[model samples]
Target: MATILMITGDFVEDYENMVPFQALMAMGHQVDAVCPGKSAGENIATAIHDFEGDQTYTEKRGHNFTLNANFDSVEAEDYDALYIPGGRSPEYLRLNTQVIGLIQNFFAAGKPIASICHGVQLLTAAGVIEGKKVSAYPACQPEVEAAGAEFVHIEMDQAITDSNLVTAPAWPAHPAMLSQFVKLFK
Candidate 1:
């Protein structure tokens, strides 16, 4: 089983954070969920982003998710893979230099990384997605392109894997995204 590091923060999408964390654990992988400036046992508020008949997704308050690891204690080399969930959180997480460095470490190590929706923002900000094909929320396409990655416009329920990276547009693509991600472990 692999030890996966999940980097998340307040306002992270509920399903994106909860489902993958639980699903990976159910598969016998050790998943450590962490947030900047927080420690194990601490909790981060989540939000539900739903697509309605609107121009974009709608947000609603979601459950509080507990952290299982301390961000400061995380050593990127200790984990076999990285999981980054999407939501409004990525918008600011990208600004954290340590967070960007952590992501770069994983990329430099050639480890597998899975990102969804806005999570691509972190990868872009880390300057590690250049020359890759990445999928993220439609609103993130421009950033992906500007970061030198080819933006993949796919179905909401689909995912794409480029080298050691697996990405999807949103949580709806969990099945495809996770399946592809797990393959990297093999």
Candidate 2:
């Protein structure tokens, strides 16, 4: 089983962010959840489920997938793959130097990297998606491309594997993306 590290930040899409967990584990890959750390060794995991951005919508209370590990404590060598579930989480993590560096390490190792929706933001911030073709929520396209990524609009159903990177738009493409990620680990 691959030691996969998955990260989530606040305003995360609860369902979409966590859905791939089931798929990954069922396929025999070991998935570990990660998020923003506050104090030393303290991390708070948020959900993307029912999270509404400032644009105005409804938001539901999210799941608390809390863990006790500082981002600095994370070692890229420990994971065989990485996943950044989309939501408002990426926006927050994109600004975190530690998280960005972790992402860089993962890519530097040529590990499988999977992201969905706004999740690409983290990769963009890490400068890992530069000149790479990617797809995300429509609103994220311009920014991703500006960050040196080639954005494409496609269903999130199947995992769009680009090099060691895999992306999807959103829930509509979740199934496929999850399956493709599982296969990557296999």
Quote model 1's TM-score: 0.99
lDDT of 2 by residue, 1-186 (tens): 788888766667776666677677777777777666543335454554432456533456667554434455578998889988887778877888888888999999888888888888888889888878898877898789889888887754555788788898876677777767666763
Model 1: residues >4 Å from true position, as ranges? none
Quote the RMSD, in angstroms, for model 2: 3.3
The lDDT of model 1 is: 0.97
- Residues forming the 10-long window of minimal summed lDDT in candidate 1: 177-186
- Which 10 consecutive residues of model 2 have the lowest summed lDDT? 43-52
lDDT for 127 in candidate 1 is 100
Candidate 2 TM-score to native: 0.84
Off by over 4 Å in 2: 38-58, 68-70, 156-158
User: Model 1 residue 18 lDDT?
Assistant: 99
